[model samples]
Target chain A: MSFEKQKTDYMPVELVIGQHRGLLHYIIRPIVGDENLVDDCFSAVTEIIVKNYDKYDSSRGTLAAWLTKVARNGALSFVQNKKYAMTAGDRQDAARMEEVADRKTPEDHLIQKENLAELKEALKSLDKLEAEILLRKYYYMQETRQIGAELGLSERAVEGRLYRIKKKMMKKMGGAIHD
Target chain B: MTDFNEIKLEELLKETLPETSLAENLGVINPLGAAVNRVIAGMVMTTITLNFLGLNYILPTVGIMLIYLGMRTLRSGNLYFRLGWLTALGKLMLTTLNLVLQVTPYVSLMDGWGLWAGQAVHILFLLFLGLGIQKAGLDAGMTNPKMPTWPVILWQAVLIVLALTGINSWAVLIFMIWAWVRMVKHIYHCAADLKQAGYVVPVSTVWFSAKPLLLAYLAILLCVMTGASLLVHYTPLDAEKLVLAEAIGVKEETAEIRSELISKGFPESVLDRILDEDLADLGSVTDVDVLQSGDNTSNTERMEGYSVSVLTEDGRVKTFVWFEYVDGKHAGLVDSVKIQYDEDQVTTDIKGRLLYEKKGETWSADVKFEEKSRTYLWFGDITEDVWSISKYSFPFMADSPRGYFTWWTEEKDGSPAYWSFNNTVFNCLRTPLVLPYVELPENADRLILFGGFGSSWGQDKFQIYATAQFQ
Candidate 1:
């Protein structure tokens, strides 16, 4: 195809998605650790980005940041399904469990809602770098190596910092979280 | 205390983590400023030159480091940025080598190739770095990014052209400055656009942090340059045997001729230094007029003796200008020598030799003529004077008492700036007295010799020379 034709063939959303492919891959790769599964998860994230491109509000957050959240959620869902597919004997029962897992019981919701406020308050006490490290590790599901590469630290260094930060947060939270 | 396990803590943290902008949260250093500094630092390295205290070396070193720092923060933005960062590394290494070269004695030998190589790397650096910024802006989804990369490249080209052509127009300089300012402003605007467009630059970690690295680099460069300056300014002396005339003794061989010249009122000091072959040239000395001489009272510490001239049989006169130091520790060797004479008197028989006192004994060596050609720009036409302006650097034998003896028909008026003088002490002990004399055609009257000295020990030293009429 001619360059002009190729340029014209791309939709605005496709162009946006193409620009953010690396970011999406970064977000999805660790969560979906398997290479094949990462490819599938990246496609799912891009699909969501395309479907919701028009709904994107730049005033609220940047396109890359918004796509990051979407990609993270998509990768996490993919991992959960992959685990269920490998472990569960019945696909229909696994689907039922997935739906039921998405919904919350009243007691669980009440307990989580009460703990979340305290968690947010505890997170505020941590520095920006500490918060970033924790968020990347837990929320984005990035590996220690990936987090180290981003934060300019060795993998072991990142792991040590993460452990210490978790300990600090645990002490600060006290009995706010349950085992 | 509640026994909260690792898995539960991870789940709690993941659930409560804010759903904010990942780019904002992940971005540690300000990528926009880094991108701008990368280009700005490139310009600063190329433009400014502070010669005093090795600032010329230090500033450029710091500027290149800044470019590397900026590249580290922005390399992940795009392929262009990645390539730019790689190019910045190459530029840094090349610049550092050139900086080290500046402080060594080999600078003169490597000057031409080093300049070309430095310019080539600088061009590549600017090209790649500018493109990186431009690409980042375009990829950031700004339709009219108004990138300054091409303009900056064009400006760089113009600068290289100006440098190669040796253009020294104030108007061009002012225009270039204005263009530079405009390019910087454009870079700032491009950065603002990239930020607005939500361009996320992932910063990479360096083994060494930027500020400390720069400070360390600056400190090392300053120390190295200072060390090099000391090495070149004061050439080291050989510590072996200590005799020049004895190693190649011509005094006994030409004792009869030298005695005759001395009887004719020739300075015995000047005659002892004249080589056997040169002593033969002065054999037919029919008349010699020893001029009145005095001690240099310019400063109390340095005591350079006055100039003594002797007329030869062929009407050519030889002048002996002695620069003896009373306080050898505080004295400086002669850096430059300029012989100016009236334009009318002309002959092509100029010879000079240096007699220096080392370890309580006087050793002699012939003056080495340093040849130089300079090309300068002229507005109307490329004149002969501008193309190959010839000059000479008079070599000095150090560790006084030291002095220069020049035999010529007449000296012409010449600018001190045009004189190519090297301030280097000759290793008289290891090497025999090797003479490569320059024969300059006599074409002037009233010869006035000028010697410029710069001492590390702050001792004021100067030379005074006068022409004597043939008796």
Candidate 2:
């Protein structure tokens, strides 16, 4: 299609909703300890994106970078307002709850749903330990200590072994990863 | 074939944007741009005022005006506009004040009552502006309504009174004008917003163009030029005169010589020798020649000539002259030596190897002469002019009181007799006429005196009068 025709085509609303749904769990799951608050923040971000679509300038920066800035600002404002509203004792209780929630293991179900057949096949070729470490680190977002414990090694040892494995994997894959 | 995964990937990246935008869509007056305008206006006014009156006071007045305008704007409900105005005004005021004070006596005002009054007024104005703006902002946040006009009027009245009673009346007048500018900006922004919203808000006749700002900047340049011109014309003409007065305590010729010797960093003891004894005024002895035989040859040389001139203790004047040279030389042939003194030091232009030492009650000199071969030639003329010579015979106590007197007078053991003028008991220590006399304790080893006063103390003259004990 010509550039003019492409520009004229109306953006599908389902596409925006589908994108939000796909990334919603991953983005909020790490930050908001409370599941209910995570859902609310996710909804707010989606609503803001829809409303301010006309103001977005393609020339200034990438969509992802701009969205990230907005998200961070929103999260900071939410935290500030929350601190002002809570009493000293209530804040302490909230903080403790957040800490406990953060310590819970992140589910790796999203990785299985998102990766393509080719990417999955590449991941399968890695030795079980290397595969499991990479998956836990990137997909589940687990801390190195927890990952190391599950794999039966010290965190430092796990890091060193992971570094070597990544290097080898990158060479074998020949520029498969975008970053 | 349609790729389901490719479609899914594209769909995952799309998200709805926020309804609220960072950029304000409502029409508002650009406060920063308006402040830039005011600053330009101030600069122009300052330049014009300086050109007409040869004064630099307008710069600070302009600052006071800007603050007034900023406060006025802040009261009118737009915080950003006030900030912009304040920033511009503050920066310009500081810059112009610094420049003006650096080049003139205006900074001396800081030592007077005007300084305190000015500071108090400035502090009050700043406090008022800050409080007014913050209160208005908080009120707006709470009420979700525009600022009431009465509070602004009351605040303006208070600000005006503060300005009028403090430092100068001009400061208050300038501030009032500034407040007017703020009100204008607020109205302009409000009107602009209404117009944007399709309401027909009336436009003002006042035109805010970049031209006014440019002109104002030109005026500042003019003020700077005027100040520089005044500085050039009014500064002292003779740097030497100024320096001399600072170095030595003399007001005339001695100061000149002191200035010269100080610039050269000559020794203080040498200067003191020339000042204390009237050696500068001794009579000349004619045709004094010396002949020397070197390893290779023999040579004869006659004295060029030398004169002694009496000067003030501070070396300001050279009153009398004593000349000596070959018999055929004219009377005007000899130039009187210039004596320079500063604080505790003195100096003269007798430039050759002449050893001067104070022993017991007398000053002794050992002179070594050389011919002008730039090498060791033992042929030269040596002339010694003693202004005052004292001869004393101790045990018999023959004291010559006509010459310079040096004695340990305060001894509790009655009178001690002197031997001979050359004897250790009869040696007369030379003290410069310009130096102050100080008493020492019975067991004191030495006495030292620093004479010149103030910051430039020995820099303008020679510091040459310090005493040391000889065992």
Measured by DockQ, the strongest candidate is 1
Candidate 1 per-residue lDDT over residues A128-164, each given as its tens digit = 7777777777776777765654444556777778888
DockQ of the candidate models in sequence: 0.14, 0.02
Q: How accurate locally, in lDDT, is each candidate? A: 0.55, 0.34
Which ten contiguous residues of candidate 2 chain B have the minimum total lDDT? B420-429
- Give fnat, all candidates: 0.22, 0.00
Query: Which of the CAPRI classes, incorrect, acceptable, medium or high, describes model 2?
Result: incorrect
Give one digit per residue, the lDDT tens place, for model 1 in B1-471: 334466677777676664333335564222244445555665566567765554565577777877776676567767777887787787778776666555444555556786777777766766676566556556544454444457666876888788889988899879887987887776565445444332355556455445566678777865765455444444333233336655433556567767776787776765555556655555355555554234322332344444555555544555544444555532332133444443334433445554555556665555544433334556865432211011222123435544454544433442111111111121111111101111121111111112122232222223343545554
Q: Per-residue error at A23 for model 2, in Å?
A: 32
Span of ten consecutive residues with least summed lDDT in model 1 chain A:
A1-10
Off by over 4 Å in 2: A1-179, B1-107, B110-112, B143-471
Fold similarity of candidate 2's chain A to the true chain A, as a TM-score: 0.39
After the best TM-score superposition of candidate 2, give how far the Cα of residue B358 lies from its true spot, in angstroms.
Answer: 49
Candidate 1: residue B114 lDDT (0-100):
69
Report the number of the highest-TM-score candidate. Answer: 1
